[model samples]
Target: MLLALRALLPFSLALLFGCSSTETDTSTEGAAAGIALTETGAHAVTRSKVPFLWREQAYDASLHDSISIITIDQKLAEELTDAERAALGYVTTFIGSECDWDGKANPEFSNLKCKTLSALKLGYQCSIEHLGFLQHWFRNDQEVLIQLASCPRIPFTASSQQTFDEIYLTTQGDTINVWFSASGVNLPMNATWEWTEENIFLAQDDAISLVRTNKSEVIRSELKFDEGL
Candidate 1:
Protein backbone atom coordinates (compact mmCIF):
# COMPACT_ATOMS: atom_id res chain seq x y z
CA MET A 1 0.00 0.00 0.00
CA LEU A 2 2.90 2.35 0.72
CA LEU A 3 3.90 2.14 -2.92
CA ALA A 4 0.58 3.87 -3.70
CA LEU A 5 1.80 6.87 -1.74
CA ARG A 6 1.34 9.16 -4.73
CA ALA A 7 -2.30 8.17 -5.47
CA LEU A 8 -4.89 9.82 -3.22
CA LEU A 9 -7.54 12.51 -3.03
CA PRO A 10 -8.17 14.62 0.06
CA PHE A 11 -11.59 14.97 1.75
CA SER A 12 -13.42 12.12 0.00
CA LEU A 13 -16.68 10.25 0.75
CA ALA A 14 -18.33 6.85 0.18
CA LEU A 15 -21.94 5.80 -0.60
CA LEU A 16 -22.12 2.35 -2.18
CA PHE A 17 -25.02 0.66 -4.00
CA GLY A 18 -25.50 -2.91 -5.18
CA CYS A 19 -27.25 -2.19 -8.49
CA SER A 20 -25.21 -2.29 -11.69
CA SER A 21 -25.67 -1.89 -15.43
CA THR A 22 -26.12 -4.84 -17.75
CA GLU A 23 -23.99 -3.31 -20.45
CA THR A 24 -21.32 -5.78 -21.50
CA ASP A 25 -18.34 -3.43 -21.36
CA THR A 26 -16.79 -5.33 -18.48
CA SER A 27 -19.84 -5.98 -16.36
CA THR A 28 -18.84 -5.02 -12.82
CA GLU A 29 -21.49 -7.17 -11.21
CA GLY A 30 -21.01 -9.61 -8.33
CA ALA A 31 -20.18 -12.71 -10.40
CA ALA A 32 -17.28 -10.39 -10.03
CA ALA A 33 -18.24 -10.07 -6.39
CA GLY A 34 -17.81 -12.41 -3.39
CA ILE A 35 -14.15 -13.27 -2.99
CA ALA A 36 -12.54 -15.68 -0.51
CA LEU A 37 -8.83 -15.42 -1.15
CA THR A 38 -6.59 -18.26 0.02
CA GLU A 39 -2.91 -19.19 -0.08
CA THR A 40 -2.86 -20.83 -3.52
CA GLY A 41 -5.20 -18.37 -5.25
CA ALA A 42 -3.76 -15.28 -3.52
CA HIS A 43 -2.64 -13.37 -6.58
CA ALA A 44 -4.68 -10.25 -7.47
CA VAL A 45 -7.27 -11.33 -10.03
CA THR A 46 -10.20 -9.50 -11.66
CA ARG A 47 -13.84 -10.49 -11.18
CA SER A 48 -17.20 -9.09 -12.29
CA LYS A 49 -20.35 -8.72 -10.25
CA VAL A 50 -24.04 -8.81 -11.35
CA PRO A 51 -24.62 -5.12 -12.08
CA PHE A 52 -22.28 -3.20 -14.37
CA LEU A 53 -21.28 0.24 -13.14
CA TRP A 54 -21.03 3.27 -15.42
CA ARG A 55 -17.77 4.92 -16.38
CA GLU A 56 -17.06 8.26 -17.98
CA GLN A 57 -14.59 6.59 -20.29
CA ALA A 58 -15.90 3.26 -21.62
CA TYR A 59 -12.89 1.02 -21.01
CA ASP A 60 -9.28 1.88 -20.54
CA ALA A 61 -6.98 -1.07 -20.09
CA SER A 62 -4.29 1.47 -19.37
CA LEU A 63 -6.12 2.12 -16.12
CA HIS A 64 -7.51 -0.75 -14.03
CA ASP A 65 -9.76 -2.52 -16.56
CA SER A 66 -11.33 -4.94 -14.09
CA ILE A 67 -12.62 -4.83 -10.52
CA SER A 68 -10.18 -6.10 -7.88
CA ILE A 69 -11.58 -8.08 -4.96
CA ILE A 70 -9.46 -9.19 -2.03
CA THR A 71 -11.34 -11.47 0.32
CA ILE A 72 -12.00 -9.97 3.73
CA ASP A 73 -10.72 -11.75 6.78
CA GLN A 74 -13.80 -13.24 8.42
CA LYS A 75 -12.27 -12.59 11.82
CA LEU A 76 -11.71 -8.89 11.22
CA ALA A 77 -15.10 -8.47 9.60
CA GLU A 78 -16.52 -9.98 12.79
CA GLU A 79 -14.21 -8.10 15.13
CA LEU A 80 -14.71 -4.69 13.54
CA THR A 81 -18.48 -5.14 14.10
CA ASP A 82 -19.08 -1.68 12.68
CA ALA A 83 -17.08 -2.62 9.61
CA GLU A 84 -19.00 -0.30 7.29
CA ARG A 85 -18.41 3.09 8.89
CA ALA A 86 -15.29 2.27 10.81
CA ALA A 87 -13.65 0.75 7.76
CA LEU A 88 -14.53 3.77 5.69
CA GLY A 89 -13.25 6.08 8.38
CA TYR A 90 -10.05 4.10 8.50
CA VAL A 91 -9.62 4.69 4.76
CA THR A 92 -10.32 8.37 5.24
CA THR A 93 -7.32 8.50 7.52
CA PHE A 94 -5.15 7.35 4.64
CA ILE A 95 -6.16 10.19 2.32
CA GLY A 96 -5.39 12.61 5.15
CA SER A 97 -2.02 11.11 5.81
CA GLU A 98 -1.17 11.37 2.13
CA CYS A 99 -2.29 14.98 1.68
CA ASP A 100 -0.77 16.29 4.94
CA TRP A 101 -3.91 18.26 5.88
CA ASP A 102 -2.93 21.57 4.32
CA GLY A 103 -5.06 23.07 7.09
CA LYS A 104 -7.04 25.04 4.50
CA ALA A 105 -10.14 22.88 4.98
CA ASN A 106 -10.37 22.64 1.19
CA PRO A 107 -9.63 20.01 -1.47
CA GLU A 108 -6.40 20.64 -3.28
CA PHE A 109 -5.15 18.16 -5.89
CA SER A 110 -1.56 19.22 -5.43
CA ASN A 111 -1.66 17.83 -1.89
CA LEU A 112 -0.56 14.50 -3.35
CA LYS A 113 1.86 13.87 -0.50
CA CYS A 114 -0.54 11.15 0.72
CA LYS A 115 2.07 8.60 1.83
CA THR A 116 0.58 7.62 5.18
CA LEU A 117 -2.72 6.46 6.60
CA SER A 118 -3.28 9.48 8.84
CA ALA A 119 -2.62 11.86 5.98
CA LEU A 120 -5.04 10.09 3.64
CA LYS A 121 -7.88 10.02 6.15
CA LEU A 122 -7.56 13.76 6.70
CA GLY A 123 -7.35 14.33 2.96
CA TYR A 124 -10.49 12.30 2.29
CA GLN A 125 -12.46 14.26 4.87
CA CYS A 126 -11.37 17.57 3.46
CA SER A 127 -12.00 16.62 -0.17
CA ILE A 128 -15.40 15.03 0.45
CA GLU A 129 -16.63 18.03 2.40
CA HIS A 130 -15.72 20.28 -0.49
CA LEU A 131 -17.50 17.97 -2.92
CA GLY A 132 -20.61 17.99 -0.78
CA PHE A 133 -20.55 21.77 -0.99
CA LEU A 134 -21.24 21.57 -4.71
CA GLN A 135 -24.66 22.71 -5.96
CA HIS A 136 -27.06 20.65 -8.13
CA TRP A 137 -25.35 17.48 -7.00
CA PHE A 138 -27.21 15.18 -4.64
CA ARG A 139 -27.99 11.55 -3.85
CA ASN A 140 -30.84 9.33 -4.90
CA ASP A 141 -31.50 5.65 -4.13
CA GLN A 142 -28.72 6.01 -1.61
CA GLU A 143 -26.35 6.76 -4.50
CA VAL A 144 -24.89 10.03 -5.68
CA LEU A 145 -24.26 11.30 -9.22
CA ILE A 146 -22.47 14.64 -9.45
CA GLN A 147 -23.06 16.94 -12.42
CA LEU A 148 -21.35 20.12 -13.52
CA ALA A 149 -21.67 22.16 -16.71
CA SER A 150 -18.00 21.73 -17.57
CA CYS A 151 -15.37 19.63 -15.90
CA PRO A 152 -12.50 21.42 -14.24
CA ARG A 153 -9.05 21.45 -15.80
CA ILE A 154 -7.37 20.60 -12.53
CA PRO A 155 -7.20 16.90 -11.76
CA PHE A 156 -8.21 17.20 -8.11
CA THR A 157 -11.08 19.68 -8.26
CA ALA A 158 -11.63 19.23 -11.99
CA SER A 159 -14.60 16.95 -11.63
CA SER A 160 -15.22 16.78 -7.91
CA GLN A 161 -18.74 18.01 -8.60
CA GLN A 162 -19.21 16.99 -12.19
CA THR A 163 -21.49 14.29 -13.47
CA PHE A 164 -18.97 12.47 -15.67
CA ASP A 165 -15.73 13.17 -13.92
CA GLU A 166 -13.26 10.27 -13.75
CA ILE A 167 -12.83 9.92 -10.01
CA TYR A 168 -10.58 7.46 -8.19
CA LEU A 169 -8.31 6.88 -5.19
CA THR A 170 -4.63 6.01 -5.52
CA THR A 171 -4.23 5.42 -1.81
CA GLN A 172 -6.82 2.70 -2.28
CA GLY A 173 -4.68 1.41 -5.13
CA ASP A 174 -6.46 2.55 -8.30
CA THR A 175 -9.91 1.78 -6.92
CA ILE A 176 -12.84 3.82 -8.15
CA ASN A 177 -15.12 6.05 -6.03
CA VAL A 178 -17.46 4.79 -3.27
CA TRP A 179 -20.84 6.21 -2.28
CA PHE A 180 -21.44 7.64 1.19
CA SER A 181 -23.63 9.85 3.40
CA ALA A 182 -22.10 12.73 5.24
CA SER A 183 -23.78 15.67 6.97
CA GLY A 184 -27.02 13.77 6.23
CA VAL A 185 -26.45 13.86 2.49
CA ASN A 186 -25.57 10.91 0.27
CA LEU A 187 -22.61 11.50 -1.99
CA PRO A 188 -20.43 9.39 -4.23
CA MET A 189 -17.34 8.29 -2.30
CA ASN A 190 -14.38 5.91 -2.14
CA ALA A 191 -13.55 2.96 0.10
CA THR A 192 -10.06 1.85 1.16
CA TRP A 193 -8.82 -1.70 1.37
CA GLU A 194 -5.40 -2.75 2.66
CA TRP A 195 -3.62 -5.97 1.84
CA THR A 196 -0.24 -7.45 2.68
CA GLU A 197 0.47 -8.91 -0.77
CA GLU A 198 -2.14 -11.65 -0.34
CA ASN A 199 -4.62 -11.38 2.56
CA ILE A 200 -7.38 -8.82 2.93
CA PHE A 201 -6.78 -7.41 6.40
CA LEU A 202 -8.54 -4.04 5.95
CA ALA A 203 -10.92 -2.30 3.53
CA GLN A 204 -11.58 1.43 3.52
CA ASP A 205 -12.72 1.93 -0.05
CA ASP A 206 -16.48 2.68 0.16
CA ALA A 207 -17.93 3.96 -3.07
CA ILE A 208 -21.59 3.87 -4.12
CA SER A 209 -21.07 0.70 -6.10
CA LEU A 210 -20.25 -1.38 -3.02
CA VAL A 211 -23.84 -1.62 -1.82
CA ARG A 212 -25.81 -4.68 -0.65
CA THR A 213 -29.05 -3.75 -2.43
CA ASN A 214 -30.30 -1.96 -5.56
CA LYS A 215 -26.61 -1.56 -6.23
CA SER A 216 -25.21 0.43 -9.10
CA GLU A 217 -22.32 -0.75 -11.22
CA VAL A 218 -20.26 2.39 -10.93
CA ILE A 219 -18.65 1.66 -7.57
CA ARG A 220 -16.91 -1.69 -8.06
CA SER A 221 -13.06 -1.89 -7.70
CA GLU A 222 -10.53 -4.72 -8.05
CA LEU A 223 -7.38 -6.01 -6.42
CA LYS A 224 -4.29 -6.96 -8.43
CA PHE A 225 -3.11 -8.85 -5.39
CA ASP A 226 0.25 -10.55 -4.97
CA GLU A 227 0.58 -14.22 -4.09
CA GLY A 228 0.88 -14.66 -0.28
CA LEU A 229 -0.41 -13.07 2.91
Candidate 2:
Protein backbone atom coordinates (compact mmCIF):
# COMPACT_ATOMS: atom_id res chain seq x y z
CA MET A 1 0.00 0.00 0.00
CA LEU A 2 2.83 2.41 0.80
CA LEU A 3 4.54 1.82 -2.51
CA ALA A 4 1.25 2.07 -4.36
CA LEU A 5 0.41 5.35 -2.69
CA ARG A 6 3.82 6.76 -3.43
CA ALA A 7 3.46 5.82 -7.06
CA LEU A 8 0.17 7.63 -7.29
CA LEU A 9 1.66 10.80 -5.83
CA PRO A 10 4.72 11.00 -8.10
CA PHE A 11 4.96 14.67 -8.94
CA SER A 12 6.90 17.80 -9.97
CA LEU A 13 5.86 21.39 -9.16
CA ALA A 14 7.01 24.97 -9.70
CA LEU A 15 6.31 28.56 -8.49
CA LEU A 16 7.06 31.86 -10.19
CA PHE A 17 7.11 34.51 -7.49
CA GLY A 18 5.89 38.11 -7.94
CA CYS A 19 2.65 40.09 -7.57
CA SER A 20 1.31 42.68 -9.99
CA SER A 21 -1.23 44.87 -8.13
CA THR A 22 -2.74 45.66 -4.73
CA GLU A 23 -6.25 45.91 -3.23
CA THR A 24 -5.85 48.29 -0.26
CA ASP A 25 -3.97 51.46 0.63
CA THR A 26 -2.45 50.70 4.02
CA SER A 27 -0.86 54.13 3.90
CA THR A 28 -3.15 55.14 6.73
CA GLU A 29 -0.05 55.63 9.01
CA GLY A 30 2.01 53.56 11.41
CA ALA A 31 5.44 53.52 13.06
CA ALA A 32 6.58 50.58 10.89
CA ALA A 33 5.26 52.11 7.70
CA GLY A 34 8.30 53.04 5.57
CA ILE A 35 6.66 54.00 2.29
CA ALA A 36 3.21 53.64 0.83
CA LEU A 37 3.22 50.63 -1.48
CA THR A 38 3.14 51.41 -5.15
CA GLU A 39 0.71 48.52 -5.46
CA THR A 40 -2.41 47.81 -3.47
CA GLY A 41 -2.85 44.62 -1.47
CA ALA A 42 -5.29 41.86 -2.46
CA HIS A 43 -8.23 43.61 -0.77
CA ALA A 44 -8.09 46.60 -3.11
CA VAL A 45 -7.49 44.56 -6.25
CA THR A 46 -10.67 43.49 -8.03
CA ARG A 47 -11.10 39.85 -8.93
CA SER A 48 -13.34 37.95 -11.27
CA LYS A 49 -16.95 37.33 -10.31
CA VAL A 50 -16.12 33.69 -9.57
CA PRO A 51 -14.27 31.92 -6.76
CA PHE A 52 -12.55 28.59 -7.24
CA LEU A 53 -14.15 26.09 -4.89
CA TRP A 54 -11.58 23.42 -5.72
CA ARG A 55 -7.82 23.15 -6.20
CA GLU A 56 -4.62 21.14 -5.43
CA GLN A 57 -0.86 21.81 -5.21
CA ALA A 58 2.62 20.13 -5.06
CA TYR A 59 5.89 21.78 -4.06
CA ASP A 60 9.64 21.02 -3.71
CA ALA A 61 12.18 23.42 -2.23
CA SER A 62 15.89 22.69 -2.42
CA LEU A 63 16.87 25.24 0.20
CA HIS A 64 14.36 23.92 2.67
CA ASP A 65 14.94 20.42 1.25
CA SER A 66 11.22 19.77 1.45
CA ILE A 67 8.51 18.63 -0.88
CA SER A 68 5.03 19.77 0.15
CA ILE A 69 2.10 18.16 -1.59
CA ILE A 70 -1.70 18.48 -1.57
CA THR A 71 -4.79 17.61 -3.62
CA ILE A 72 -8.30 19.15 -3.65
CA ASP A 73 -11.37 16.97 -4.00
CA GLN A 74 -14.96 17.97 -4.89
CA LYS A 75 -14.29 21.46 -6.24
CA LEU A 76 -16.98 23.96 -7.24
CA ALA A 77 -15.20 25.87 -9.99
CA GLU A 78 -18.32 27.68 -11.21
CA GLU A 79 -19.38 28.91 -7.81
CA LEU A 80 -15.77 29.66 -6.85
CA THR A 81 -15.56 31.82 -9.94
CA ASP A 82 -17.73 34.34 -8.18
CA ALA A 83 -16.37 37.53 -6.62
CA GLU A 84 -13.84 37.70 -3.77
CA ARG A 85 -12.21 34.33 -4.32
CA ALA A 86 -9.14 33.44 -2.27
CA ALA A 87 -5.79 34.04 -3.99
CA LEU A 88 -5.13 30.35 -4.45
CA GLY A 89 -8.72 29.88 -5.52
CA TYR A 90 -8.31 32.78 -7.90
CA VAL A 91 -5.18 31.17 -9.31
CA THR A 92 -7.09 27.94 -9.87
CA THR A 93 -9.73 29.98 -11.60
CA PHE A 94 -6.90 31.45 -13.62
CA ILE A 95 -3.49 29.63 -13.70
CA GLY A 96 -1.87 32.75 -15.08
CA SER A 97 -1.62 34.13 -11.54
CA GLU A 98 0.44 31.15 -10.32
CA CYS A 99 3.48 33.42 -9.98
CA ASP A 100 1.95 35.92 -7.56
CA TRP A 101 -0.71 36.09 -4.85
CA ASP A 102 -0.65 39.76 -3.79
CA GLY A 103 0.49 42.78 -5.74
CA LYS A 104 4.23 43.69 -5.48
CA ALA A 105 3.81 46.53 -3.03
CA ASN A 106 0.98 47.04 -0.56
CA PRO A 107 0.88 50.18 1.52
CA GLU A 108 0.62 48.05 4.65
CA PHE A 109 4.00 46.39 3.83
CA SER A 110 5.99 49.58 3.35
CA ASN A 111 8.46 48.91 6.18
CA LEU A 112 8.79 45.15 6.27
CA LYS A 113 11.41 43.61 8.53
CA CYS A 114 14.76 42.49 7.31
CA LYS A 115 14.66 39.02 5.68
CA THR A 116 16.50 36.85 8.22
CA LEU A 117 16.82 33.64 6.25
CA SER A 118 19.10 33.51 3.25
CA ALA A 119 17.56 33.98 -0.18
CA LEU A 120 17.47 30.19 -0.45
CA LYS A 121 15.48 29.77 2.75
CA LEU A 122 13.42 32.88 2.09
CA GLY A 123 12.56 31.46 -1.31
CA TYR A 124 11.79 28.05 0.15
CA GLN A 125 9.70 29.46 2.97
CA CYS A 126 8.08 31.74 0.46
CA SER A 127 7.02 28.71 -1.54
CA ILE A 128 3.45 28.08 -0.44
CA GLU A 129 0.63 25.62 -1.08
CA HIS A 130 -2.15 26.90 -3.29
CA LEU A 131 -5.48 25.17 -3.90
CA GLY A 132 -3.74 22.50 -1.82
CA PHE A 133 -0.75 22.73 -4.20
CA LEU A 134 2.21 25.15 -4.02
CA GLN A 135 2.56 27.50 -6.95
CA HIS A 136 3.74 30.53 -4.96
CA TRP A 137 4.93 31.73 -1.57
CA PHE A 138 3.20 33.55 1.31
CA ARG A 139 6.08 35.92 2.11
CA ASN A 140 3.99 39.11 2.33
CA ASP A 141 0.33 38.15 2.23
CA GLN A 142 -0.95 39.51 5.55
CA GLU A 143 -4.26 37.67 5.21
CA VAL A 144 -2.48 34.36 4.65
CA LEU A 145 0.01 34.96 7.44
CA ILE A 146 -2.86 35.66 9.82
CA GLN A 147 -4.96 32.64 8.82
CA LEU A 148 -2.48 29.83 8.08
CA ALA A 149 0.47 31.06 10.10
CA SER A 150 -0.01 28.02 12.28
CA CYS A 151 0.59 25.57 9.44
CA PRO A 152 4.39 25.68 9.69
CA ARG A 153 4.32 24.28 13.21
CA ILE A 154 1.71 21.57 12.66
CA PRO A 155 2.95 18.05 11.99
CA PHE A 156 3.79 17.48 8.37
CA THR A 157 0.40 16.17 7.41
CA ALA A 158 -1.18 16.74 4.04
CA SER A 159 -4.40 17.30 5.93
CA SER A 160 -5.55 20.65 7.30
CA GLN A 161 -2.99 22.78 9.15
CA GLN A 162 -0.08 20.34 9.14
CA THR A 163 3.61 21.22 8.92
CA PHE A 164 5.94 20.24 6.13
CA ASP A 165 8.36 17.48 7.05
CA GLU A 166 11.42 18.48 5.09
CA ILE A 167 12.17 21.63 3.14
CA TYR A 168 14.93 21.96 0.51
CA LEU A 169 16.52 24.69 -1.58
CA THR A 170 18.83 24.10 -4.53
CA THR A 171 21.33 26.79 -5.39
CA GLN A 172 21.32 28.50 -8.76
CA GLY A 173 22.71 26.66 -11.82
CA ASP A 174 21.80 23.23 -10.37
CA THR A 175 25.02 23.11 -8.38
CA ILE A 176 23.95 22.62 -4.78
CA ASN A 177 20.91 21.48 -2.81
CA VAL A 178 20.58 22.88 0.73
CA TRP A 179 18.59 20.80 3.19
CA PHE A 180 16.70 21.76 6.36
CA SER A 181 15.29 18.90 8.42
CA ALA A 182 12.25 18.79 10.63
CA SER A 183 11.09 15.70 12.57
CA GLY A 184 13.95 13.64 11.07
CA VAL A 185 12.42 13.69 7.61
CA ASN A 186 14.57 14.40 4.54
CA LEU A 187 14.01 17.56 2.52
CA PRO A 188 11.25 17.26 -0.07
CA MET A 189 12.88 18.81 -3.10
CA ASN A 190 15.74 19.58 -5.46
CA ALA A 191 15.46 23.11 -6.93
CA THR A 192 17.26 25.43 -9.38
CA TRP A 193 17.78 29.13 -8.83
CA GLU A 194 19.58 31.98 -10.58
CA TRP A 195 20.83 35.14 -8.90
CA THR A 196 21.06 38.18 -11.11
CA GLU A 197 21.81 40.61 -8.28
CA GLU A 198 22.31 40.56 -4.49
CA ASN A 199 18.90 42.08 -3.72
CA ILE A 200 16.26 39.81 -2.23
CA PHE A 201 13.31 41.15 -4.19
CA LEU A 202 15.09 41.67 -7.48
CA ALA A 203 12.61 41.92 -10.35
CA GLN A 204 13.52 38.83 -12.30
CA ASP A 205 11.95 35.56 -13.37
CA ASP A 206 12.97 32.09 -12.26
CA ALA A 207 11.18 28.76 -11.89
CA ILE A 208 11.09 27.09 -8.43
CA SER A 209 10.42 23.33 -8.30
CA LEU A 210 10.42 20.75 -5.46
CA VAL A 211 9.49 17.10 -4.72
CA ARG A 212 9.46 14.59 -1.81
CA THR A 213 9.91 10.86 -1.36
CA ASN A 214 9.10 8.78 1.68
CA LYS A 215 8.89 5.17 2.86
CA SER A 216 5.69 5.41 4.86
CA GLU A 217 2.10 5.28 3.63
CA VAL A 218 1.24 8.97 3.60
CA ILE A 219 -1.64 10.43 1.67
CA ARG A 220 -1.31 13.53 -0.54
CA SER A 221 -4.42 15.36 -1.60
CA GLU A 222 -6.10 18.73 -2.20
CA LEU A 223 -9.36 19.33 -0.33
CA LYS A 224 -12.06 21.61 -1.70
CA PHE A 225 -12.96 23.06 1.67
CA ASP A 226 -10.42 25.54 2.98
CA GLU A 227 -8.60 25.05 6.28
CA GLY A 228 -7.75 28.78 6.04
CA LEU A 229 -4.74 30.41 4.42
Best-fitting candidate, scored by lDDT: 1
Question: Clashes in each model (backbone N, CA, C under 3 Å)?
Answer: 85, 52
Provide the lowest-lDDT 10-residue window in model 2. 195-204
Q: Best-fitting candidate, measured by TM-score?
A: 1
- Per-residue CA lDDT of candidate 1, range 67-182, in tens? 21112222222321122223233333322211333434344443332222221122333244333422111222122232221212222222122221111111122222233211
lDDT, residue 221, candidate 2: 33
Estimated TM-score per prediction? Answer: 0.19, 0.18
Q: In model 1, what is the error at residue 3, expressed in angstroms?
A: 29
Task: Give the Cα error of residue 52 in candidate 2, in Å.
Answer: 5.4
- lDDT at position 122, candidate 1: 25
**Alpha carbon lDDT at 56, candidate 2:** 26
lDDT, residue 105, model 2: 31
Across 86-130, the per-residue lDDT of candidate 2 in tens digits comes to 222211221111122133334443222111111112221223432
* TM match of model 1 to true structure: 0.19
